[model samples]
Target: MGLRPRMAISDIEVIAPHFKRRLSGVTSTVVQLIPKQLEAGVKISTLGPGLPDDLPKLRYRDLLQCWVRPSSGKKRIWHARRNIEMVAGIFLRDVLRMPMKLVFTSAAQRNHTDFTKAMIRRMDGVIATSGRSGAFLEVPHTVVMHGIDTTLFHPPRTNDDLFSASGLPGKYAIGCSGRIRHQKGTDLFVDAMIALLPHYHDWTAIITGRVTAEHEGFHAELEERIAKAGLTDRIVFLGEVDDVKLWYRRFSLFVAPSRNEGFGLTPLEAMASATATVTSDAGAYAEMNVSGSTGMIVPAGDGDALRNAIEPYLADPGRAKRHGENALAHVTTHFEIGGEVKGVSAVYEATLAGER
Candidate 1:
C-alpha cells in the first residue's frame, strides 16, 4: 500500500496513549498500529512511557497541547487499550478541559468488573477487538479484529537451511511462545514435546518466553521433566526473544497452547510467517485459522490433543509446508494489518464528524 506523507506535529489528529511500560499485548498493539496510522496520513503520535524510542511520541507535558483546537478538526482522538490510559484520557478531556475524544478498545472475552463497565460507559466511543468480546460488554462498541503486519511476518524467500541460519539443531522446528506459566499452558507444550520428540528426531521444539521470579518453580519443574526425559537438546527454551518475528518464520508448526486469552494475535503472526499452527481454542485462534486446512485447533490445555494435532506434520513435512502456504494466503485475504488500521481510521473520521 502507498503511504501518505507523515503529518506534521501541528496537524496531528490522533493521540495513541500507552501508559504501560511493559511489552504486553496492548503495548504491542500500539507499536504495530501507530506507524500504520501515520503512513495512512492520520497525523498520529504516541504518548506515555515504555514505548520504543523509534515511535513518534509526545512528551508528558505535551498533554497541554490538546487544549488547543485543531485548525481542521474539532478535537483529537485519544485511543486507549487499557483502563489506566482510558481513565487518564477521560480526566484530560473532561476535568482538564482538553479538546479530545476518548476511544477505548476492549478485548476481554468474559464479563468485566463493574468498575471497568463504569469506565466504558464514560468513553466517547469503544472498540471490541473481537466479536466474542462484544457479548461481554455492557456499552456499545465497534468490533475491529486485530491484524498482522504481513510485510514483517511473511514467508521467507528460502528456508531450506533456516535451522543452519538460526544456529539451532534439527531440520524442522515446532515452536510455542508466550510467557512461561501454567495459565499460558507452557507446561502442556513442554509435556507434549517431551512425549513426541523421541520419534521425530528430525524435528525439534522450541519455547520462547521468559519465566518471572514468581514462576521460577514452575519453570524449573518443566526443565527437570525435560532433563529426566533426556530431551534437553531437542526441547529447548529460548527465554524472551526480541526477534520473535524471525523465530516465527523458522517454524514448521507454530503452536499457541494458551489456556485463556482476551484475544491473541500470535496465530495470525504465525500464519503471516507462512507457518502452519496448532493453536488452542482459546482467544481468536479458531476464528483466525480454517481448522484442519490452513491450521489446526485443539482443546485448550490438552497435551494429548495438542500432540495428536502435531503428529501428522512430524510424519509428513511436505504437508506441513502446504499448510503453511495456505496460512499465508488466508492471513493475506482476511487479516492483513492495513485492514485493521483502515477500520479504525473510518471510526476516527465518523466520530470526528459526530456521526459515530
Candidate 2:
C-alpha cells in the first residue's frame, strides 16, 4: 500500500523491556527494516535495560520521536505500577519537552484512570493492539493487531520430518508454551489434563517454560497433582527450549489456557506453525481463534470444557489436521509481519497528521 496523501511517516522505535531472542531473529528483523522499506527517511532506536552499551547513539536531531512502552516488573501487579510510573516520567518530563508526538501501546499503561490519566492526557495518540483493549482505554485509539513472522511460522510441507524428530510416534501430543504462573491459568490446564487422562491414555501433555520463585508453591502443587493422577509418563516438562519453532512443529495440538492477555502471541505463533489449538475464550483468544475452524475455544477456568474441546481432536487425526490447516491460513492472511507493520505505520502517520 502506498503512503496516504500528505502523510509523512518518520523514525520508529519499539521499547520492549525484555526482547525475546526468538522474536528478535524474525519479527524484530522486519521491524528494523520497515522505515527503509517505506522510504520514510526514518531512523529507528531501541532503549531498554538490556540495551547494549556499544550500540550506536542517535543525536536528538537525528531522532524523529520516541514511543515508549515501559518494561513490566516480575510481579504482575508491581509490574503494572512500575510501567505507569515510567510512562509518566517519560511523558511528563521528556516527551513534553520535545516537539514530537507520543504514542502508547496499552490502555493499562496509557488510560488507567488512577495511574495513567496524566500520561494519557499528554499523548498525541494511543495505538491499541486489540478492540477489547481500545474499549477499556475509552480513548481515541487505533486497534492494530500484532503481526507474526508467517515465513518462519507457516505450515510445514511434511509432518513426517517433525514426527521423526519428536520421537513420540502414534501418540497425540497436547502442548502448552508460556510462563508457568497463576495469571496464565496453567493450573486450569493441569486440571484439564488430569480430567482427560482416564479416557485418553494415549494422549500426552507437553509443558515448556520456567516458573519463578513466586510461583514455586504453585509449581510444586502441579507436580503433586501430576503424581497423584499418575501422569508421570503422560505429562512431559521440556522446560525452556532455545528453539520454540522446533517444539511447535512437533506438537499435534497447541493449547493456551490464559486468563487474560493484551493480545496473545503464542496462539498466533501456534496457528502459523500449523497446529490445531484449543484456547480459553479470554482476552485476545476470542479474536485470534476461529471456533470450529482454526481452533476451539472453551470458557476460561473450565476444565470440563477444555477437556471436551480437546477430546475431538485426539479421537480423529484428520479433523485435527484440517483444523491446523485452517489456523495456518488464518494467520497468514491476517497476522503476517508486513500487515502488522502497515497497521502500525498508519497509526503513526495519522497521529503525526493530527487526524486523531
Best by lDDT: 1
lDDT of 2 by residue, 33-65 (tens): 343334443233432333333332333333233
List, residue by residue over 1-356, the lDDT tens digit for candidate 1: 34234335467778888887767888778878877877788778887888777787777776667788767756888898888988898899889998888888888888889889888888887888888888898877788989888878877767542755877789899999888999889998888888889999999999998888999999999999999999989999999997888888889889899999988888899899899999998887788888888878998888889889988999999988999999999999999889999989877877777764
lDDT for position 294 in model 2: 93
* Each model's lDDT: 0.85, 0.65
What clash count goes with each model? 0, 1
Question: What lDDT, from 0 to 1, does candidate 2 have?
Answer: 0.65
Candidate 2 accuracy as TM-score? 0.79
